[model samples]
Target: MLRWLRQLFNTSPLEFDESWRPELVSGFQHWSLLSQAELDRMEMLVTRFMATIDWEAANGFELTEQIKVLIAAQASMLLLGLDLDGYDDVTSVIVHPANVRLRGNRPSGGGTFSSAPIVISGQAHYQGPVLLSWAAARRGARFPEHGHNVVYHEFAHRLDMLDGVTDGTPPLEDAAAMARWTAVCTAAYDEVRAQGSPVLRPYAGTNPAEFFAVATEVFFNQPHELCEHEPALYGELRSFYGQDPAARISRPRRHHQHG
Candidate 1:
């Protein structure tokens, strides 16, 4: 009975065709230059990713081919290690030109009409929807060295909220892991709030939810800096994420450069 019920609710991940344009970049060259076998693997990932999203169009991307690919790749990477790991709760992804126009300071508004610093490149609604600026996502993919990735930032929030709330806690696979994660993440959150300037980002100090998003940005962007500056916090992030970006930060990530 349980199996049948699960089957009834299961849907495939969100998958898009290979219609987007390509860019020539050394760092993210894999998206354009990966071998057929690798590309096939990426496609598989994309298919599983589709299961996680109920993709809707806001303002579709009008940017360069590279930007579109880059944004898709980052969103794909967030789902790399898990099955059915796309933004399952989200039914749509609204892509805009840049920092979306603000309707007000309300956090409840959807992406199509919102204002900001309004330098937000991406934002995750509490209900599991996402809004990303194609320009910011492309820029982050082009330059992953800096500590700013709108894709990672926003997607991380979605992941964190999977536990039924948009708190810093995401779904942990085990109690032991959850305990360690809580300890470390809480410590990091407190430190960031107290110091005003954190190893991850000042924005993380904005709130617990923002801390998760900002930490994700640093995790994918300034990994080594995060490790060097805040080794304890970095260790926690590494433990929770099950990936070590610092290792790749030092060397070129040919095998895992899709994100």
Candidate 2:
């Protein structure tokens, strides 16, 4: 009876395809930087993500395995040191062939909106599906040095929303960590709004939520630049995300660039 019950309760993890390894290594620049253990963990997350999320292709775009894996791998990277439940609210992922154009009220600036046909690469809705442009996602994965990844940006918004708020700050370990995060992020956000930053792009200054998402893009893509220019922000992100990307990446410093 005990053996029968054991078999009844048995379960298996999702299988990861070996063929996807090359696709990931070739498409994602950061794939080569992960340790063996981290790689194993990432594979687990990737498989689960690809299997769990409801993936859709807009405009009759062909949704291939390559697209799913590439997007899943990047999304999983964010949860490397965190729990998968952080994304429990995300039920679907919609991919567009290119930039999404919407003729609706869009945020202009300073707490206002304009009814213009705005083109966006990605968008994250609170407790809703994430929208991504395949062109932007593919470019961001293959060329991370540009410091603008739609997947990272949208998923970071999802993380920020996990606390039931769309503000820049995500859930922290404790009050002390939250305090430090606020201080650091506020300072950086203010600087970006005022004098502007070399590492962070102008779009980051749009709002606190966008700032966090944009910073996440730079934190992973241009770790060296962020570590060098905005050490405090980088340190806060490193502690919060539980990953020191600067240590994993080894590249000579170059002039700051944005995507």
Local distance difference test, each candidate:
0.64, 0.87
lDDT of 2 at 166: 87
Q: State model 1's lDDT.
A: 0.64
- Model 1 poorest 10 in a row by lDDT: 250-259
Top TM-score model? 2
Candidate 2, poorest ten consecutive residues by summed lDDT = 1-10
lDDT for residue 244 in candidate 1, whole number 0-100: 71
In TM-score terms, candidate 1 sits at 0.74
Candidate 1 residue spans exceeding 4 A from truth: 1-41, 47-68, 105-119, 251-259
Q: Give per-residue CA lDDT, model 2, range 108-223, as digits (tens).
A: 87788999798899989998899999999999999887788999999999999989998999999899999999999999999999989999998898889999999999999888
Listed per candidate, the RMSD to the true structure in angstroms reads 6.8, 4.6
- Residue 236 lDDT in candidate 2: 94
